[model samples]
Target: MLLFDFMFSETLNASLVQSSLVCLATFSAIIWWLRPSRSRSLPPGPRGWPILGYLPNIKFSEWCNGYQTHDVMCKLAEKYGAVFGLKIGSKDVLVLNDYESIKEAFHHTNMNDRPENAMIKNIDNLGTGILFSCGDKWKEIRKFTITKLKSFGIGKRSFAENITIEAECLNSEIAKIQGNPFYSRPLLEPATLNVISSILLGQRFSYDDEELHFILDNLHRNGKVVGSGGALLFVPSLQIFLKDKIKEYRHNLDVVLKYFRGIVSKHQEEFDPYIEKDYIDAYISEMRHNKDKGKQSYLDVSNLVMTLGNLFAAGSFTTSETLSWAILYLTKHPEIQKRAQEEIDNVLNQNQPRLEDKPSLPYTWAVVLETMRLATVGPLGVTHAVADDTRMFGCEIPKGTMIMPNLWNVHHDPALWSEPNEFKPERFLNENGQVEEPPQLIPFGTGRRSCPGEQLGKMELFIFITHLLQKFNFKEAEGESPLTLEGSLGLTWSPTPYHVCAHSRE
Candidate 1:
């Protein structure tokens, strides 16, 4: 016991010494690197510790409670203007706060790649998927995703029909609640997942499917956990100590991977190689057709699994969470809900809401837009990296610098909006009663790396919200606390747990 204790103590002490030395080296490098170099033209921002950087100023509890990382950047931007930098650990992240700066920088080839994170590297399929990849691999997969998704008719009537079918299932599931207060998270999650799953897996799960619900529940639970724990992704030394947290994240994604793998294996056994039925079959068909090209081709079994699953996982959470926020906001301010419903009534008038009705139902669409801006899901909208050394806003952005577009800042900047903090849908409507999409209202982002799933997400959000509002009036359930705008920031900005009483408008 004494020998074991001695060895353990020695190991612990050595780790501490290593950490301390790293700290010292980090500071020494910063001090030497920042020593009045006229050639260095980095942006103006906060000065952090040697290795620790600005992480000391970021409070995890703040993000957990309501304040998000993007919100932190916004406050810092108040002092540092729209284009500023934050040294996080050993990395320098250039934060773009305004629409103009972000728009300008995002399209620059030198500023349009993705960052490498230990956390994502560990979760990603050998860093082979779209969300955290770079170079030719990223280009190939991205082009493939865009082309395949479009070929599958992403924004067509058949696609809307898929979403509409899910809406019918969602309504039936909500009706099962029998007008009692229900947690809308579970009810809404499946509807969104089902639509995306159909494209990726060629099938959808029933609402009661245990594995389906497990993926959904963990997505909500782990998005916040992984997002909160994301600091460790940048801070390497701390990651080893936080093994359990990393493992949990791995395990959550593995569950999703496991589900996808099973589906792939089933398809593999039945893969006809010549026929393409869905996204999976299409890829498999391509792989079989291109086997002679060998490694020259990016098509493979692993990419097939991770790419499709990543697409599936990415689609489910944020869209559903945004809808949840919309419900919460509309319920908290019944006046907004009433106005939205009246618009629906005026246009559809008991007829089922259709995508064609979108133009006519400007108020309802405006309310949804307001929710996305106020809630600001995926605030940072994934970290970007510079493709090459570039200059922006009169500052030098070297190659490999992390670029973060603070969409939350753009949405909430007082100078950009009439009342940034207020939830007013009228801000989106013009004197002509047509919905005006503000240039600054960039929820989906822009440029080559912008979200490819934007159109599909918008379709699902519109169909789901219009249908739900048309059928039911959402109110705070009895014995529940008043709905709060305070949300938990995970993969997306999500509302804290709240229940709603659904009254059938019929």
Candidate 2:
């Protein structure tokens, strides 16, 4: 009995020793993981607990959330100056609130590459689509796209011809409303979608078509998902644990990618390189040619799919939002609207307003400028990641730091503009009554990764505004506030749903 008891005690002692050793190993592992890497030094900001980072502080509600993000970052800028740090789940992002810091980080070539985020990779893999690609691949593809866009009539006669058709269609649709308070989605979406569709697929859909509706809805939803809670993308392992949200994201991407794939597959069977018809056909031909020569090409089938996706999604949102805001503002300020109409009518004299006419109609241009400033989409824009450790505004931003350019802060900065909150077009006009472009209104962002679609976007806005204002006087629906500027946060800031009645100039 004595011997058995001693043996039992020895076994118990061994077990306790093993448990203590295991605890020590686990504690050491935690310490090692939390310890900052010896590679590079990072900028300073609020510290977070291990693993989760500052994600707990991220509020996801749309209305309060966007403002909260803007305000919090602004406060941090006050405390930390232009450059500061933020953590979203084990990841640190350096936020750039002022123009000087933004230019230093974004405009310089060293900081040009896209960040190493899973979502960015997912986007790149799903389609080395223009929005997410980096390096020589990006430069080659972008150069090709720029060349193609220009050749196909960006700032050329072909583009003008297409815009005229879309303008006519938009005008005809508005005329159908007969001066009633009709929701403009049916008319506006098709017009905007076709601007891209004609460029990409060489096709256009009627506003009432079911397929177009489905595509638009899916695009809209995907944009919302990507723009919000997209930080989920950076932590892919969480996808396995949080299966439902990732599944939804996958489903949305699959739906759009599948649609694009179908288009590409059809083009592959019947595409003609010699013809050089539409964007996809040109890409398909290029892809095949590269494959034959054993040279890697950016215009692969996946890229074609994503390129169309990027073109459709990116092109549609900002233009639509800007137009929506312009209409709303005109409705609120009737006198300004009247003056714009007068300028369009007097300058063009029943002729379609050309791009060159933009200079002649200073007030008309001012209205567009004000719309851009007041309704800057992506108030936060897309979150950009640092390519490497860098300094901005005297702060140390480590490599792999995500950069958020606060375009909202830039557009609304009281230091830059007088009465920053007011919707004043006159601010953009010089004492000489000419439209003076301000570098401070950075609606399109700046630097190596700035938006490539700026000229197209500006053209679309000018054409749409010219046609709409010339034909109809926008007015508030009864008992509605025309000055109401509510935006739902997404990959872009979109106006909250509202209706404006079109009063015909007839």
Candidate 3:
């Protein structure tokens, strides 16, 4: 009995000693970390918890099947000054809220380099497309896309012809509604998808096609999850622990990838140098020629497929949502809607409006600009990471710090935008009938990684809005009064599903 007690005592002492030693070592390391390295200049923000840093202060809720970190991050920036530091897991992220700091970091500083983070590098298939890529690969792809876009009738007669066909199809479909209150999802989403599909894939799917429906459904889910701040932004570490959400993300990507792979494979099997139909065919043909000559090429099948998916998602969703908002805005404010219709009628004159016609339709363009500003689809713009330890706005930002540019703040700031919340299109036009310049208008973002799809997106928006206004007079659906302005948070902040009446113009 005495010997057993002695053994127990020894074991207890050993455990206690080990625990004390561990505590001491942790304390010393923390002290060293707190000392602030001479080379490091992290931006100032609210102090965080022990070990947790500022994690608790970060609002992370999984209420709607995903995290709401972006909303939380914005609120934090409001509380703390624009450029603040946040410790998310082991990494430190700097939040740049106001225009001044974002301008300095993104523009004046012009450090448009890919962040050195594992997550970015981890996206397997999408290796250096026009988006989320850096250095040589990005430069080459971006330049190639710019040249290809111009060649592919992006701002030319062919593109306008394609848009006109899609717009007419959309008009016919909306006409079938017979002025009844109906959900915009069916008409708006499919029409926008068809426009982009025609542009990128060189084909359009019938509204009833089963395969297209599957593709749209998968894409919608992927966008929803990524757009949700929690899944992608807040608890990325905790994401591994959540098996179901992770599975969904992978499954969603896989399904989309399968469709993309099919496209790439078919393009490969039916390659003809003499005959190239669209962007995909051209890209595949170029890639094959490069490969044949023993040259290293960046636009491999995988990258091409992923880029298509990215383009489809961005192009389809943003344009559709913006048009939806245009309809909603018109319904809510009929005066503005009437003015837009008048402008379109006068400018178009029974002819399909081309991209060049934007100059003539100043008021219509202003409404589009204002809608972009007010809605700001990708609200918290894609998260940017610092490539190196840097100082900005008198703060010491460490390397691999995730950056959240609260574009919402920049867009809605009373100082920059007069009568910020009001849906005023006149703010976008000057007396001479030109797009009034605002150097800080960063809807497409700035720096090296700005959206390459800006021109295409603008064209889509212009055509869709013009066509819709010309054909229909939108009105609020019964019981859906006081149309909800709230957007579901995710990679893109989309308006909550609401029905509106597309009263056909007699």
Candidate 4:
């Protein structure tokens, strides 16, 4: 009887211990779920799920609901104010929604670094390019690239002749369609690419060049893939599940890189320091000079390849896409197109548009500015990072925090633009009937890290738009659905594929 009593006591003790442990676990979980998510130092934002944070929300909204990443961010900003915080995976993301916030944050020296995320690191393993590199390397390469490109007539009036030549080529391509409805990207992209190519590769590719077509095809495809799969960069653990997408992204990037590598190799073989033919030749000369000095420098073969890749990708894609958006908008709004053409006609008198004629054509320039504002191609801009723990706009941003400048928000902000959704070129004009670009019109971003190609891009826009409008009238295709201004987000916010009838103005 005593032994039986002891056995019962032991069984009861075990049950009590097990029950206590279960309760403790349940209580702990509740505390974790209900914990104060907002750090006193951080900006206000949603209290997302434990561990995963706001990543799932972003993915679901983008994948399931067809919302663009920028659209999702704008919605969050509506609730959280201009400065919002989010914990994306293991990183802290601070999104600057207003022009003030973006301007201050981008100009801050400490806030100038690029995110050293897995995906970014994978793109240029050496981290040698101007777009993604930080610190001295970026500064050195950027300065050199800018100086060299200028010498090659990138931003100067001398380059206007080359652009005019390319514009003529594009005009011929469009004229081939003979007023039939056609997609503009195929013609526009190559024309823009050739302009940049003259500076970078020192030669132009014929429209039917097999190699150029292959590179362009891959580059365009990768832009879309990056938009859809870019979240993987923020939450790398998800890569395991989305291996196929990651693989495709890598493959596309690899194909482009392979072509660039061959070009770089050919340049190296034919490199002559005394005679600099193009940007590549100038870079090789610099590399050799550094070598001759026995100096440890970032100007090496790897850096050159990656820098060229960055230049080629950025130099062509954004400008071409912006032009595509311009054409789409003009096609949809024929009145705007006619007015712009009239302004061009009045200014140029049937002559090819020149860079110097920009000031003389206020309405046409306004049209370009308006298109840039409405389209907001790089909607999210480039993701920035804090080099150290810093305070920005009354929030304590942690070191290595990911900074997202929601260019879309700033462009579409009701406070900044009247009827922000509508296309109004006059918004860019003042009472004086001259072009007036407000400080808020930051289509290529602003501050130190703004696009180096800004001037060149503007030059391209002015030259191409004026020339195109001078020679042709763009309108919606007959028997086709109206083109929507709503753009699909990729590496850029590009117009949906639509056919435009380009009738000869002559």
Top candidate when judged by lDDT against the true structure: 4
In the range 1-506, model 1's lDDT, one tens digit per residue, is: 00000001122367775886687677768685564321235688876655556664565325454455666787888998888886766667788888998899888777767666566564444435776667787888888888888887788887788888899889888877888998998888888988888888788899899877777776655564456555555446446545667777677767776777888888989988666778888877777767855547776777777786567657888798899999999889999999999989888989987787899999999998998898888787777888788867787678877777888888988887878889999998889989999888888887878888999989999999999989888888988777777876666777998889888888
Residue 240 displacement in candidate 1 (angstroms): 3.8
The residue pairs found clashing in candidate 1 are 110-387
Structural similarity to truth (TM-score) of each candidate? 0.89, 0.87, 0.84, 0.90
Model 3: number of backbone collisions: 14
Error of 3 at 465 (Å): 0.8
lDDT of each: 0.76, 0.72, 0.69, 0.80
Candidate 2's residue-wise lDDT over 181-251, tens digit each? 87765577788888878888888888788878878888876665555556655544333334555556678
RMSD of each: 6.2, 10.7, 9.6, 10.9
Best by TM-score: 4
Extract clashing residue pairs from model 2.
378-381, 389-399
| Model 4: per-residue Cα lDDT over 326-376, one tens digit each | 898888788999999888888789877999999999999998999899998
Q: Which ten residues in a row have the lowest lDDT in candidate 4?
A: 1-10
Q: Arrange candidates by TM-score, descending.
A: 4, 1, 2, 3
Q: If ranked by lDDT, best first, what sequence of candidates would result?
A: 4, 1, 2, 3
Model 1 weakest 10-residue run by lDDT: 1-10
Q: How close is candidate 3 to the true structure, as a TM-score?
A: 0.84
Error of 2 at 397 (Å): 2.9
